[model samples]
Target: MELIVDATPTATVIRVMATRIDAPTALQFKEDMRAITAGFDGRIILDLANVEFIDSSGLGAVVASMKQLRPDQSLELAALQPIVEKVFRLTRMDTIFAIHASADHACAAGNT
Candidate 1:
């Protein structure tokens, strides 16, 4: 799980650089997210534009990432591919997150 971290005034964007987030990479993803987000004080926009697929374990990792955040911090999702979006929707996880069309959009929305 390769993720590019881009910090802006409004939010920290973590762009996932892989096509798939499945069983094999789920643990690494969680660990990386923990390291990247530790002590972060603002919103985190997870850019999923490059992720074409995701499995249940991958989804669990994402949720776990959010759970590990500090009380003042947040985790949001953006630029989800169709398949990945479907997975979130089918699982109703979409209701648990603030989903954006893109990272830019998420940043533009600010704290909303």
Candidate 2:
């Protein structure tokens, strides 16, 4: 899993480099996310712009990543492709996480 980690004063933006987040990549995704978010103090924006698909396991991994975060920190998802977004909607996960139109929008929304 190749994750482009961008660190800003506002948030650590992690852009997924993979096209599909299916069962095969779910475990690696979790590990990468855990390692990526090990010490950040600001908001965490998961930029899924390039991700075109996500399976149930992938969704579970994303949810688990959120649960693993420290109490003071938050995880927001951004730039979800249509297919991926549909899965989130079908699973009612859109209600659980703050979804943004784009990574820039999420960054512009707040720094804290």
Candidate 3:
């Protein structure tokens, strides 16, 4: 479970280096997210470009991650592949999280 954490001016970008966020990696995902997000501030962008598939557990882990953040802090998602984007849309999670087309777009300085 490799996560590349990039601290940008507008948001902290956590890029998941792994390919799948499924039953096998869900627990590790939550644990690692908790570790990295500790005391973090501002908006957080989860880069999911490499994640091709996500199961129910994976979705649950994502929700848990968002919940763990401070209420004032925001958790956005970026670079979702087709399958994963479909999953979020199908589950009506797209309405819950800010979904971006790409990481670069998410990090754009003027974005709010």
Candidate 4:
């Protein structure tokens, strides 16, 4: 699980460099997210533009990531592929987190 971290004035954008976030990479994805988001105190946007697939474990990992965040910090998602977006929608996880069209759009929305 290769996650690229980009810090902006408003949020930290972590881009999923891998194409899939399934059972095999789920643990590593959560671990990496913990390490990368350790000190961040603002909103964190996960850019999933490159991710084409996400299984149940992957979805669990994403939810776990949000659970591990500080109370003041938040985890949002952006640029999800249609398939991935469907998973979130079908699972009703879409209502749990704020989903943006893109990382830039999330950033533009500010801390709201």
Candidate 5:
């Protein structure tokens, strides 16, 4: 699993390059998110376009990452693969966090 973080003026985008965000890669994903948001106050957009699968731990890690962000900051998610989207909906988290169809949409949310 590879986690690449990119920051925009309005949001920090974290892209996960992995087939699955399961137990094995969840911890690293959480840590990478922490490191990326350490000194930033902008909104967060986690891009999951490359993630094909996600397990319970993986879902938990994503939630944990959101919680880890500074209280002043906000967290959003974008570009979720179909299977992963199903998980979020099934877990009823689709309503908990802002979900966007694309990164552009996510970023635009902060703009307006």
Candidate 6:
């Protein structure tokens, strides 16, 4: 997983440029997030622009990261490909994680 971090006024944006987010690399992705935002407070906006696929384990890892964020921190997802959006909607996870049209939109929504 190749993740690039950007600071937004409302959240930390992470653009993931990976073909697939399956079992093999989910853990590393999660660990990378943990390491990158160690002392930060606010929200996480996962920009999934380049991710074409995600399995159950990948979804689980995302949820786990949200859980790790703590009592007040927020985790949101953005720019999901149609296939990935379907996965979240099919699993009823769309209602759980806030979805946005873009990373900037995600950060803006989280700010409010």
lDDT of each: 0.96, 0.93, 0.93, 0.96, 0.87, 0.86
Summarize candidate 2's per-residue lDDT along 1-112 as a digit string, tens digits.
Answer: 9999998878889999999888999999999999889878668999999999899999999999999999888999999999999999999999999999999999989854
Give a tens-digit lDDT track for model 4, residues 70-102.
999999999999999999999999999999999
lDDT of 3 by residue, 22-41 (tens): 99999999999999998588
Q: Give the distance in Å from residue 14's predicted Cα in candidate 6 to where it truly belongs.
A: 0.9
User: For model 1, what is the error of residue 12's alpha carbon versus the real structure, in angstroms, after optimal superposition?
Assistant: 0.3
What is residue 29's positional error in candidate 6, in angstroms? 1.0
lDDT of 5 by residue, 1-112 (tens): 5777778877888788887989998898888778877877868888999889999999999999989877888888999989999999999999998999988788877788
Model 6 lDDT, residue 14, Cα = 84
Best by lDDT: 4
Better of 3 and 5 by lDDT: 3
Per-residue lDDT, model 5, residue 103, is 84
Comparing 2 and 4 on TM-score, the stronger one: 4
Q: RMSD to the native, candidate 5? A: 1.1
Which stretches of model 5 miss by more than 4 angstroms?
none
TM-score computed on alpha carbons, candidate 3: 0.95
Candidate 5 whole-model C-alpha lDDT, 0 to 1? 0.87
Error of 6 at 10 (Å): 1.5
Give the Å error, residue 34, model 1: 0.0
Spell out the clash pairs found in candidate 1. none
Q: Estimate each model's TM-score.
A: 0.97, 0.96, 0.95, 0.97, 0.93, 0.91
Judge candidate 2 against the unseen true structure and give its global Cα lDDT, from 0 to 1: 0.93
lDDT head-to-head 2 vs 5, winner: 2
Error of 2 at 10 (Å): 1.2
Residue pairs clashing, model 6: none
TM-score of 1: 0.97
